[model samples]
Target chain A: MQLALESNAFFWAIEYLATFCCGLLGGLWAVRKRYDFIAILMTVWLTGLGGGIIRDVLLGIFPPVGVSNKGLVITTLLASCAVAVVYPEVDGLKWTMATLDALALGLYAVNGTQKALMYHTSGMTAVFMGLITAIGGGLIRDVLLNRVPSVIGDSHWYTVPALIGSVLTVFSTRAYARGVLSFTGELVCDLLIVALVVCLRMLSVKFDWKVPGAIKRKQYRF
Target chain B: MQLALESNAFFWAIEYLATFCCGLLGGLWAVRKRYDFIAILMTVWLTGLGGGIIRDVLLGIFPPVGVSNKGLVITTLLASCAVAVVYPEVDGLKWTMATLDALALGLYAVNGTQKALMYHTSGMTAVFMGLITAIGGGLIRDVLLNRVPSVIGDSHWYTVPALIGSVLTVFSTRAYARGVLSFTGELVCDLLIVALVVCLRMLSVKFDWKVPGAIKRKQYRF
Candidate 1:
């Protein structure tokens, strides 16, 4: 059965956009890693859909949106191919990638939190899933490419923004549910969360505000 | 809610054993990669419980057993620490590792298939999930460690054995459902599938039967 998307069309639309951005980034990664065509395609699929799949699976939604949503699958594929074709031009535009990453992070964080709440998950779980949906695909992509996940290393405050966005989504949505927040207020909350994340991400990138000491020389094996 | 396990005591027992094996392997891998204590612990948890988590999520079972089953978590942690302690002594025994890997593969394949069938999944999906359960954790471990997944590269017929076991489990269980196979016959089928996989794995290891040209030099980027 299809996921119940009628109730949150706006959120899902953002999710799709985020998915495409992740897909393109994955393709870029495949190029950077010098992987062949098949590997690139596989990476694209994994990166584009991995987070949503993780979210859906955790929520006990069968035949995950990643698997059943043909439109999304095709969109990610096309995004991947397009990025692959334009890799040379895009490779030099570091600012563009950073912007896209921030935007995707914001979109995914909000969308993921909303979906988790829809499934009646606890607020804590919804926040966790929001982070997963925002960053899980890129983690998988990096892992598959045989690199330490950037999020755990040189992420430069990547997760903090997502976390803030997720927390905002969860608390605001709860307020709305309890009738403490108006519909307009709820809509503002959503936009505000997204804006906060994107802004935080851009500021982090500009300022290089990385979490210190997370990068350590390997010791104490096992 | 907990998974429906009342009808499959034997399967669950084997699954636990398999989980222990994977946890140990994860510990060993972490050691090989020279990760610190916390990273090792994370690896152990991921490798031990990741597959079951994936399976349960796909089947729409929320709050996965990995999160809910405290005993399993403790068990995996203990298993990982034990492996880490004894790794130097065990390092010389290559055959031992191959044997354990084979056994874990067999156990997970059968357990995954049975769980999928319990959920009334299509045979194809069941088989796919069975393979996922059997290998997904290892893939995660390798990826996190920045290596190509062994199943994709150096596995030497890994998927073949898992596929065979999964296929047998699905078909035999289906037969049992139709009353064409007696309960005793179904049990035999289960045992046979596991045995077949383990044996095939060992034989492939002995013969060093790598898949034909699945390995290619990375050339066509993006």
Candidate 2:
């Protein structure tokens, strides 16, 4: 009945926090874009909940956690309100957005991988799904607004951190060998991985770490 | 499919022209938004085929027709290039875009409905699928690009035209069921519906026949 016995509480708590962080970041993003409070709320809610809905739908699950989870909804609203009131103090919005977004990217990727493993998916599929889950909501947000997606663009360590988190999740799950593991151990691994991804992404931002190859290419028709 | 003769030929042509129109519109929209050519091309490709790809993937098919169909690829590229080159000379692009977009909406709606029917979906389900198919790509495009969706935001007959076209398609298919009309007759109905939608959209612009119903509802936190 349960995928991982000890993780039930951890998953829910982290999911709630991720939604909060994502919503806060999304609201601040709207501020940079000069949206109204309502627009900001809508965008934040979408960014916080959209990827989960999409993943659930793709898995043929109904109600999506987004629609059913009150915590996510309330967190989005709270984040939107916070951004509206406190945004004046957050100077250098671009840098703030990037830093917070990097943290979000790591958290989401780790969470996505965990959730996908719960669905009994293989390592490769779980990794890909995790990466998608991390960035998918933002992808939906950008694409719906008719802008290019940041995940697919040459932004700073956007997909790289997500990929790292995903890989860590897949390996950790495998290392457990689908068997039992101590709750504390699992949490320790999860935190270590998240911290690693965040640190790696931050360093990537500082030292220009990239995928080692042509991350960007342009093609034209004559 | 083997559902009806000329099915392949019809969809082949439909896919090409639809991609062209959508891609061209996407390119022009990017020009208005001040993106580079690659950005424009990416948006165009997404607007042209993203919806159908989602539909196919949801249907449990691999390598979605939208991707494997090279006609769509070439059409998307050519149309985006054309728009990029000619957008400057295309005076009064707002009105022009409105009309062309309306036409594309109708055609995609009809085509999407037929695709659903051929897949043996119930009429009501087909209608829902058709609406999603018609607008899903554009919605994704807008959200990714950090802009408001035109269909949901603009107090125009955007969804209205697509709804009308889908309804007409259902009726035409029903008539086909009764042997009251030939497939050619159905084709004729489709063409007429597309033309009618385009004309109505343009006339609405010319005469200021826009609907103002949802404007109040849109007055929210944003």
Q: Best by lDDT, which number?
A: 1
Question: What is candidate 1's lDDT per residue for B32-58, written digit by digit as tens?
Answer: 878887877888887888777777777
Model 2 misplaced regions, further than 4 Å: A1-48, A67-103, A110-132, A136-222, B1-6, B35-42, B49-103, B115-132, B135-164, B182-222
Candidate 2: tens digits of C-alpha lDDT, residues B32-60 = 65555555665787798777767666565
Q: Compare the candidates by DockQ and give the number of the best one.
A: 1
| Model 1 CA lDDT for position A202 | 96
**How good is chain A of candidate 2, measured by TM-score?**
0.82
Candidate of highest TM-score: 1
For residue A147, what is the lDDT in candidate 2? Answer: 56
TM-score of chain A of each: 0.87, 0.82
Backbone clashes in model 1, listed as residue pairs = A60-B60
